[model samples]
Target: MKEKQVLIVGLGLIGASLALAIKKEHPNTRIIGLDVQKESEAFALKRGMIDEIAESLDLAAPEADVILLCSPVEAVKKQLQIISRIPLKESVILSDAGSTKSEIVDLAETLGLENFIGGHPMAGSHKSGVTAGDERLFENAYYIFTPGKPKDQKRIKALQSLLAGTQAKFVVMSTEEHDKITGLLSHLPHVIAAGLVNQSKAFNKEHPGAGRLAAGGFRDITRIASSDPVMWTDILLSNKETLLGLLDNWRGEMDQVSEWIAAENREAIFQFFYEAKETRNQMPIHKEGVIPAFHDLFIDVPDVPGVIAEVTGIIGKANLSLINLKILETREDIFGILQLTFKRKEDLERAKECIEKETDYLWYEK
Candidate 1:
């Protein structure tokens, strides 16, 4: 195989992480990076994502064997316009990290590009930017490849090899399928999260009393709404058509719940709740030999020194790793609750037994 020179056209988290994964996997291949923001370039360079940073793509386009455009969807579309007309090395295989692909694929076809591949990694955090770059972010994540037809098989093999460190299974999907499915699973969630936060705030303003009691649960659920609104707005707009379909489907379910409550159909409401619980229970277990599911185990402790310490000690002694913990310090709330995470049913049972045996703490949430 010929020695490779890879050019990463953006210095965001996705781009920098991809650079790091490629560097770790292919040390023989030199990586070049270009970003519009000077701070982003500096951060990516300091993090050692790219071996050298370029001032312009024009200066760096000629040498790359693989070129990754990891800019935003709109930005990627515009960059592809400029990139396709550039004096790129004829053998360079181009791939993109845009979340949306229909618009990008259209742009590529418009530019008459033959070796371009559309891609998305199914791992994104609420975090952003070059400073948020973590090499292991893509580890065990799914990477979807929407390769254009008539692509060189060698290029496909080379691109796949470059991403070997991601532990990402590269599944091939058409550009249209990728957009529609993602708009449902990925994009729709952001839309709903943001909308829920907005609707809650609007209701609070009208009711006024609800604002006084925005509890830990509401705060936790709405945390995704705190993510950059500009990014969410851009995604929602770019994937509007498919998102509308998802929104309508979600509304249909919401309408059923509303009708059941209005008619005082307790049986139907309880049945719906039961079905939801059952469906959630069957999810994949993150812990080996255990069912994958999210369950709430709430322990109440008095507001005193070492209360949190004493509670966690029982959990640790019982050998259960807490996945997430939050302490609420709001006034008028007497006891603090600890929501523990355990992979196995055995661990949950053990922790419950240990707490019941060793401590006088009250279990409030099941």
Candidate 2:
């Protein structure tokens, strides 16, 4: 078979990771990269993420079997415009890793590009740039596709084959469906997190000690607020309609809670909390369908030397690797709460049991 050529425009985390994954799986495939930053191209080449740099879509798109736009949402739209003017291979398939799908998909359709599909990998890190890219970044994550035609199954399958190394679960849905769904899950959460952080900043400016007294839970909830402002700004503008509607829905939910509190309706408040707990607990703890889940164990342990090492040693001795382990909440006067995350349920269960049996600490599956 003739070696397939993949042209990745932009060498940011997602673009570089895709290139690395493809090269790892199919070393014979010709991987071409296009980026405005020459340094990114150099970095990707040195790390074997891409075979060569094309410099522009005009040179790359014509020879590419698959072209991936891994730029921010606004840039993805501009690239689509450029792709519309460029002469591409008849069989060339185009896609993107943009967060907003409706705009990109609509633009592709308007451009009369039959081979273009919109895709978003529902996974990312707070880290950015080529140096942060990892081949396993997309493993077990959901990869959503919004194709122009339902019968574009062959093209979808071809694209999937090219990205087989990602190990991502494929999901096909309409552009509108994707926007609404992601707006609720990803976009809205970012808005809320940023709002909370901004609220804290305003309060701290007046109170003067609030920021210094902030704890782990506050940082954890507002972690997403530290994301790149430029990238998030583009995403929010692109998905404005869906996000606004979601915000209104969230406001309604908050108003109901406020009313219950004002009325001193204990049963209503208890029922609300109980129902929310029940619903949240029913969510899958392992990667399934479009959701990427976590297996976490929360433990309360004393603050002392070797405490972390001792806890990790037990899991390590059991031959179980942790995805992430951290002291989520700690205070000088109170027992610290440690949270351990594992990629597998069996590993999580084993870690919980190991910690419970080895120490006099309290532990539970989170």
Candidate 3:
């Protein structure tokens, strides 16, 4: 039997991570990669994320048993068109890691690619590029597949077998269902976050202190706004119709809230927030979903020179890693709140135990 050859296009975070994950599980399987950015391709090759750099898609597609388009939605669509022109192996399973799937699935059907599957791995980092690739990036995350036809089940299973190394939970849904869910859970949130940031920017121009004052809560919610603007623009445009409807609904929601405030309807306002809090509190905290969960532990430490180092020293001594650390609220007179972020729940739990054992400081999980 021939050794499996997987071709990965776009050597960014998702692409590089996917390649690394595949290599980790199937060391003998040859991985070929192509990226528009020469540096990304070189980086992936040097880092052993890919076995070889493909000369072109046309040259690579015919040889690949599995082909994954890991680019932005628009780029994925263009690549689909390109791949449609190229002759692929009879058993080749084509898929993509685009966030939005409806348009891509429609395009695949239109292009006569019967074996193509629309995939979105619901996991990511704020960081991008090949340098940020990690083999465990998709571990325990949902990998949704939108197969265009009933007959594509065998091919979908084949693709899943190839990607089993990712350790992502597989989910199958219709393209329409996938789009509507993602538009609400992912794309719509990004749009709202960006809109909030822009509105704050306009306000900051009129009031200089406004931006600085918008720190903890505002920064937390708008963090996704800092994502790659070009990528978000492509995603928002690709799911324009769904987002348009969502935004219309969002406007109606805002109008209701505005009226509540205007009419001084205290009970209505309280019920609104009460329902939102109840719904939000019911969401699974530790599970990785469409949005990444932050396993954060907050420590209250003295506002002194060595306090941060002392806390970090404890975590480091235990051979634990922190995703990020920030001083949320600090003052000379009061204990400073230090935020420690972990990628996994186990790490967070272990870090908490270490902090408790090693320090006298008070810590809490939020």
Which candidate's TM-score is highest? 3
Estimate the TM-score of every prediction: 0.80, 0.87, 0.97
Residue 268 of model 1: what lDDT? 98
Question: Quick one: best lDDT, which candidate?
Answer: 3
Off by over 4 Å in 2: 288-302, 309-325, 328-335, 340-363
Residue runs of model 1 more than 4 Å from their true location after superposition: 150-153, 207-209, 286-302, 306-325, 328-335, 339-366
Greater lDDT among 1 and 3 belongs to: 3
lDDT for 355 in candidate 2 is 80
> Which prediction has more favorable TM-score, 1 or 3?
3
Which of the two candidates, 1 or 2, achieves a greater lDDT against the reference?
2
In candidate 3, stretches whose alpha carbon ends up further than 4 angstroms from where it belongs are none
Considering only N, C-alpha and C atoms within 3 Å, which residue pairs clash in candidate 1?
A: 284-292, 285-292
Clashes of 1: 2
Per-candidate RMSD, Å: 5.4, 3.2, 1.2
Clashes of each: 2, 0, 0
lDDT (10s digit) by residue, model 1, range 1-366:
777889999888789888888888878888899999998988777878888898688778877888899888878888888888788877779989888888887779789888788888766554688887767666556688887765456766878888997766677788889888878766777677778888888999789987756756786566556666665676778788888888899999999999999999999999999998999789654422101133456787677778778888878776676646666552344876667755345667778889999988877544
Worst window of 10 by summed lDDT in candidate 3: 149-158
What does candidate 3's lDDT look like per residue over 122-203, in tens digits? 9998678999998989999999999997658888888788888999999999988998998999889988998999999999
Q: Look at candidate 1 and tell me the lDDT of residue 34.
A: 92
Error of 1 at 62 (Å): 1.9
